[model samples]
Target chain A: MPRENPLAPVERELRVAPRHRLDLVNEVDADVLALQAELERRGYGPAEARRAAVARLVPGGRVIRQLEDRHRPLLGRRVLASGWMDRAVAVGAGAAAAFAGVVAVVATASPGGAGMTAAIRWLLVFVAALMAANLGRAAARLWVQGDLRQEERQLLWARQTGLIVAAVAAGALGAAWEGYPVPGTSVGAGGPAFVPQSAVWEAIGSVAGVAVVGLAVAVFGLFGWLLVTPRLITDEECERRIDDFFAQSRPRLTPDSTKAQSHAQ
Target chain B: MQVTLSKRINELLVLAVLDQGPAHGYQIALAVEEQTGGSFSFQHGTLYPILHRLEADGRLRAEWHGTGRRRKTYEITGAGRAELAAGAAELEVQFRALLGLLRGCHAA
Candidate 1:
């Protein structure tokens, strides 16, 4: 036979709610049990105090409804609400802008290159266009989604977005100036260029090689950063964020207080 | 008769009460009601969610203090105290501003 739960009726009622959390039910069990004991200690009969405790705590199924609103799986809401998501988006855009920097460098450095360079220049150029498209894409999201928890954080998000845009603009101009096409000169002729014309494929290979190295460095840096920094926000922060969801998640004026105030008046 | 408090005020009050000393759910709620001179009260049902949420946030630390129907007692953490201090200051400012506005209205 199972041990008797003194707050069985209260527990049973809370449990009856659809998809109710057991942890909450148990806590309520302890609360009501304690309240009943306190009432008994204050001179109420055992049975009367038990009945009163249940009535006081679980009034009209309100708590169960409030719990449903406040404590349901909050990962989706947190992903939207936590300021870090916007930060991550800003960081991503910044990295793409940095890659755009490489694009400007390659474009101005493309003329009169060594052999085998043009062979891979096209691929790097493709990636450069892709970054430009991504910068625009990221910028669009920033305009529509500035919903952070605090005004200060929202301002930070704006600043980060601004920095990303600045980087992109500067990177494009610099790379274009540096990698300008040679004037009136074919691959075999002297022209307005930097490195002397030779193996186009080899220059392309060199750019790709540099890109590979940069990508490897970024991956390792991100991994190391993750290893060192502890995640600041936990599920608890979500509970705080959704304050309005559980509109009645609050304490109340007890019957005793009202009587005390009324008697004094 | 029960008067439900706003969550922010309730949280602030809870933290303030716990700052005095450690207590379990029932004792904390009772203390708040008694100390407020019947101005505030907490239902067992309504308070558990807040307590659990606070515990999760590291604002309050809980430990089962006794055996055989032993209750889970809560102590205010450093974070809880910091929040309480901030909240108290904000509330005081708001009340002062409110009082000033009301007095000006009466004068008018």
Candidate 2:
């Protein structure tokens, strides 16, 4: 059977292992130790320092969960600190970049003598934007989960795939733009004929259009991941905190399983 | 009751320290003690583990560089910054409510 997470303590007041003693940890981890010291500095008691030490050690989500499990009854501050807003920001950025790519493509594709190749250049720009947005989101998720997610891992790989495709398409576009030389007019024994110069904007538009597609892929892929994944990773750190804080207090109630599981990214 | 109050206060204090900039486990300890007039001092040994834990949780991140010889530095992440702000705001609300509660009887 699956074991209980070590971080999943039965009691909210549970502490860390003796070897991971608060006093011992305080001496080594300056940031939190400073926090513990400040408690003692402010004349707060040892127990208070210890509890705060644990809170500082764990992610805010875990700490908040622990507080709630204890029936602390107050949660506004903790919720805000979990950084949910930042996650939303990442999603929004991705969507906007994808939308821009689409617009570029349409402008390039227009038939009134609009140059497809020029539009393609604009598409490249959109592709770059798409890449940046996805990368940003991935980085945020990595930090949020304190690890990588399967979908995000896939997205990362797809990024490499995307690069290859872009390179090939760019090469083709370059060849077409330079080789054709904009329908150059030439004198022939047959008769005079009009040759239209390649429209720079048309190429720009085509590139932009292609970029839109790339952005769409990024947006949809991220969206699918968001939809499919339980989204447990974002809360993983907090969950660990919850498990640990409670587990330490009620040792017999639940065995610490986090030690056995390398669940976090 | 005191434990609850103290935990909130401690979080506030440490975050306030970080607001100044990032510091290592040792530096944070020193800063906390110094800021609190030595009334507070961590065991020094215990601080590192806690900092590691924080880093694990995304509240802080580590930056290792070759400084003179060897030393690792730590800084708060954006999430940590947000947490600090949230914590401060909560404390402010609590303090205000507490002040009002304390003053109500006298006013009446």
Candidate 3:
């Protein structure tokens, strides 16, 4: 009674190889979500969005490849490794700063040009340490996170760190060369105790100190922003999103039409 | 012993599963489970999407027919068969190489 079956079933089930299959359905789903978001932003309706999304994936174009590469396992792994490296550098720099500060404070308190030289040397070392740490953090975010937003935040932080440290280092070095106790009120002296400080060296050190302080203030203000943007998407969130993606992608990835129908139910 | 297959290797498994016979969706899913001794399971929701894409890409062909009730059946295309062959050969080479490495490690 029914029309001759259009499709005849083969006697044997097709065989699949163990290799060359990846549980990347979730990753593909993420791409679809991203694509959908883009389409919505562009004012496309849901139906149009889906059609376009399929078109984007098929015909062997590199479009899907580019999207897939973004969510690659290797990319996530690299991001995690970078985070570890950044944290390590940050800790090391903090330690170096503490060491340098202690040395500078102790050495600077004593009298003579030698004390000033030591202070300057210690300041230079401290600043260099801070710069290195900031650079490490920036590098980690840029290369590992693969998030442009995070990279920008790190870049800003690094720039401020560099500026502040450079000022501190230059101020200390100049003061040492000038052979003067930094021009501030001496404990017993009256009338702001000029202390016969050279106008040129004093002016250089003052400018450098002011610049460093300014940089520190800028970095402090921006610190909150750095924490807010580009958060490390947690492992749980990653897993959940990946799961959702696979679920949505099942219809397209599966070949047996009947299976897709059953699953859709 | 049950071997662990990762998500990355699941696509190959799908092809392998289909190779057993011309099965509708659920049947192939069952076959995969049976052959792998319940070690490997296909997610119904995810599997269909892959199947549709494979059909669209000409790796598989789908036909709608009525057998008392309406149902869709899919079969691998020539292209799909070729792909399976290539995939199998590549996997065999990899497995042998991995086995050699594992044996060497055990010897050490």
Residue by residue across B1-108, what tens digits does model 1's lDDT show?
232437778888889899998876767777888899989887646776677678878999988633322346789999999989988998889889999999999999
The candidate maximizing TM-score is: 1
Ten residues in a row with the worst lDDT in model 3 chain A? A5-14
- How much DockQ does model 2 earn? 0.07
- How do the residues B1-108 of candidate 3 rate in per-residue lDDT, one tens digit apiece? 342335325556667766654555545554566688988765423445556556666878766554322345668778877877887787789889999999999999
* Alpha-carbon runs more than 4 Å astray in model 1: A1-20, A74-265, B1-5, B65-70
Give the top-scoring candidate (DockQ).
Answer: 1
lDDT string for model 3 (A6-113, tens) is: 010100111111010122332223333344445544687766765554444221323223333333345445544466646655665676576546545543443332
**Reference-based TM-score of each model:** 0.43, 0.32, 0.32
User: Between candidates 1 and 3, which one is better according to TM-score?
Assistant: 1
A53: Cα error in model 2, Å: 20
Worst 10 residues of 1 chain A by lDDT: A227-236
Per-residue lDDT of A1-265 in model 1, one digit per residue for the tens? 4434433434344322112233343345456666766776688887787676766564346765455435433532354456566765576677667766666465437453333343334434444545344333433332223112234334433543444444344334333332433332344375535454554454444444444433433343333333322221321243243322233222322333332222222
